[model samples]
Target: MHPDGFAADLARKPDVLGRLADTLRAGNPWAPVVPPGIGRVVLIGMGSSAYAGGVAAARMRAQGLVATSELASSPLLPAWGPDTLVVATSATGGSVETLDALRRLPAGLTTVALTNTADSAVTESCGAVVELAAERENGGVACRSYQHTLALLIALELHLAGQDITSLVASIEMAAEASAHLLDTETTWRPQAADLLLGPSGMHLAAPAHRFCSAQQGALMVREGPRRSAVGCETGDWSHVDVYLTKTTDYRLLVFAGSPWEAQMEEWTTLRGSTVVGVGGTVPGAQFEVRYPGDDADDVRLLAEVLVPELIAARAWQEQF
Candidate 1:
């Protein structure tokens, strides 16, 4: 096998991350987040398209903005308020739901569109645009594009919110270092292991909506990796009922989180005989833990974890190429 063939499985996230990390050099990290004194920020999208928006919203909220993330098709739209900043994130830039919401935005609302396709409908409807080149064939269920979108939004939030962009960028450097180590060392020989992941039974992944939006899509890549059914659920919620359904027969794959609860969860997963691969800074007890560095290292590791699964999925589908 080619040395980098293993990289196919790891490619999804780092490709996007390289793009995301580059935004540290962006001239306007502190550029206006909104027209002066905005009351709220509405981030809109659907599906993984919405996931990218959620990443942005998380950073906005972390930076202390009254930000809200909603489906592009939310029954409510905020327009009466002057401080409303609408951020539309779409990987394809042609998501039907986002296009519809873009049209619904009232005149004078500031719109920022993040997309891989500059010519798509979402771009046409927005006031400002961040053009990205989505670089996957048939896009692999929206890969690097969404990651870059999240990266851009994260950087933008850190910059504009006056929340210490310098430190954040420093952390991105750390994350990149950690990602390189994982790709070159830990992930180097995991493709064959991926075959073990293939089975009639489903694959179980855990993360809350906070991590799910991005992690779920990346897990789908793993589904492709092993050509099996993969189900993602929130951790504590999964603990309530779903984990009880786990049996020796179920092909469970645990993606460990860095939450304080992660150590306990990781222990539980091992006892159940689930295949565990740990990524991020705090996923203790994982069979394979890749420590990603960042100011919010845990979260950065969470997002970066998606790439490993994507590479695994690419392995399963390699014959098609």
Candidate 2:
């Protein structure tokens, strides 16, 4: 990788952390308040922004909060009231449905904003704004901004969960060092993506134990790579419940690991081949592999792993796009 390019990319991450820390600081000026009990933690956003919001809800649950995750456009909406904390997310702060949802939240509700654009409608309308890392560089598509929001949200989750994120301070620094070696090794991932790129634009398979809502986020990025269609689903659901429809060979599958059944699916995928790739125990007869840093490979490891595919489907496919 060119030093200029690497430096520029690495430089952007710190800027993200700085902005995020600033937002939490801004919130700090006021005493932190959680309703008698946050009846439910509600997150709303379209595309990756909403999906990224789930990261917070999950960690909050890990910390003993009753949390629920939903896309801003959930088919059936949640019951909103004063005790509800609705986190409205929008990368541009202008996603049509997300902005509309933000506009309609009940009065007295504790509404928070997580967005890349502090000046956009959603940001302007909320109680507080966690301005994300959307620099001028994130012009058309939001790759850099995506990383910014994901990391910032992660930091917030850790803070809220009462975990000492100080341990992660060193880990965050290592990402820069690791990203250097990471970009160099990811050159190999391109070759293995042959079948990975097939199907209806893109795919997602999330762990049941993990955030299944990530499918919504992964689909948005995949559609950018190929506008046909994209869907997020669970491997266990696909293997048992969704088995019939997927047998048709009409759409492609991007498998995210978790849940007990996925171990079996990896085995069964060979007998009935499914187009797959990523860092996991390969499906039998698996001919392709994507080798990036282990931390970077979490597109299989963590819920944040969605970035691996966004990098490929968005950045790597730049010319074809």
Candidate 3:
């Protein structure tokens, strides 16, 4: 992947998201495919697509719907039933595993494809297609597609829950503004974030459970673009899983900064003298804070905060060449 192209893909987020918002404002794209009496939802994808699907599935479950996100390559996909809905997401509409999963589903099942390409193999395989409309990422990165996937999946969640989508549309607009703010002011925060997060041992990212995809996607951007070692964990889970690294390594953590467990993470990081970078909200002991226009809103943070690490990854990746 070209680092400069990855940066360019990120820079277009606000515009692409604006277009997506307008498209949503026009109407619910899933209406034609999501029929009544859908008792269960199964979403499958690989990598960043799966990361976004996981958050969307959790949100759907919170709304009292039986929803689950599975890695496309999983051998244990739940048994499909007449009342089940399957959604397979692939940015390029060409993920082999996702397609294999789709092929395994019984023919004529209510299956949908979410992809940026309109005429991809995924679209031909699924009964319906909801294009991401994220355009091409010449960089070979999935940055814009990932954000659009999250936004669209939120819309799908609301639609499935029989809730109005106006709020989601507004949130998308807010995300666009937040993204623009971050991109416009990158010079103010990029260096410090890069320095604080790019430690010798690599980067660790944590986010609230509902927004955990941010951490995953952020870490993926670093590893995918810059080839850095990065790992993502749910904020509360960090104390149990990732805290040990802080004491032993030149640990650098990027906290997405809204978890109730932030204090718990801070307690350990402070004690270990680990470098911490906070985004979207306050982390009590963070060495650096990155804020933007709509940082206060959790939905905005979910949709926008990753831009910080993405920008850092792009810059670091670019400099290496």
Candidate 4:
């Protein structure tokens, strides 16, 4: 890998988020309370930022808000109204599709933007901005921006739900440390990812983040890194549909779990003879576990779990380009 690679930038996640913690101490950006009578919230972004929108949508739904996430490129953008809250998130705030979606919102509709870059397009298109208190993404993979965006979205959700976030806010440092620990201990995970003999790989996520979108970044990493074919599917959906077509021994599987189907998927994959690594949650009989090293309520899992796939890409693809 090059000295100035994505891996180098990823190593600095702890500092990026620690600064975010300090920024939060001063004040939260999503303040003064979410207005009453909000009908629904639509979170729009492209790629990884769109996935962050998914996490925020799930958090908002748990808080009893009617929320949904859509791609900025979706032709069927949700109908906008006075009561709708439209949020556009882009790491650079410069994605043409996301900026265009924000521009098309009703003039009086409430719109918010979460971004790392200031004076980018979305800032002008939206009514409010919660600029991430983090640096621009390096290595072209957006490792820091992706993690910081998720943190910012979770903070917004906590404030909107009127919950005390003192404890949640304090866990940021712990999360970074825990992430570092995971990376340090799992030293072989990255090298194994470059194995020439490894077969096609698959990724499944059990979360509000849809499978394809959740795995989108990881798939890109593997493609750009090891230059291999990788596929993604929702956890249960994969268990039911794709499981039948594959010989268990034909593929290696990685499951990012935060749902109840963990054990079932583990047993199924084990029966099929595929190796599995569980992150964020465990799967019985799996070969390895990249445990989410914090309490269940800790939002750091969202930030930390992606490091596994990222490291793989960095090791395999870093010097190729």
lDDT values for all models: 0.62, 0.56, 0.92, 0.69
The residue-by-residue lDDT of candidate 3 on 151-189, one tens digit each, is: 989989988888877998999999999999999999999
lDDT of 1 at 146: 59
What is candidate 4's lDDT per residue for 147-261, written digit by digit as tens? Answer: 7777777777777677766756677776787667766766655555334214554433333233334455566566655566666556666667567634743656666666556
Better of 1 and 4 by lDDT: 4
- Cα distance off (Å), candidate 4, residue 183: 3.6
Tens digit per residue, CA lDDT, model 2, 1-321: 232332344345445445544545444311343334446667787666656667657766877866666777665657756677777777777888887776666688877777777688887778877666556543255555665655655665555555655434444444433444434555566445634654553354444445464555566656765443666666567666555544565434555544566666666555556666643334333456443344434322442345445545555344453
Q: Give candidate 2's error at residue 27 in angstroms.
A: 11
Candidate 4: list runs displaced more than 4 Å. Answer: 1-3, 32-37, 186-189, 192-216, 224-227, 295-298, 319-321
Candidate ranking under lDDT, highest first, comes to 3, 4, 1, 2
The window of 10 residues in a row where model 1 has the poorest summed lDDT is 1-10
Deviation (Å) of 17 in candidate 2: 6.7
Cα lDDT for residue 261, candidate 1: 56
Worst 10 residues of 4 by lDDT: 203-212
Highest TM-score, which number?
Answer: 3
| lDDT tens digits by residue: candidate 1, 1-321 | 231343442444454455555665564432753456656788888876676676567767867877877898886976656667788888777888888988877787778887777677887888778655445435336665655566666666765575556655555556556566556654554554354444557666666556765456766655544456777666656666566655646545556464455655656666787666554544544555444444255556544666556666665667545
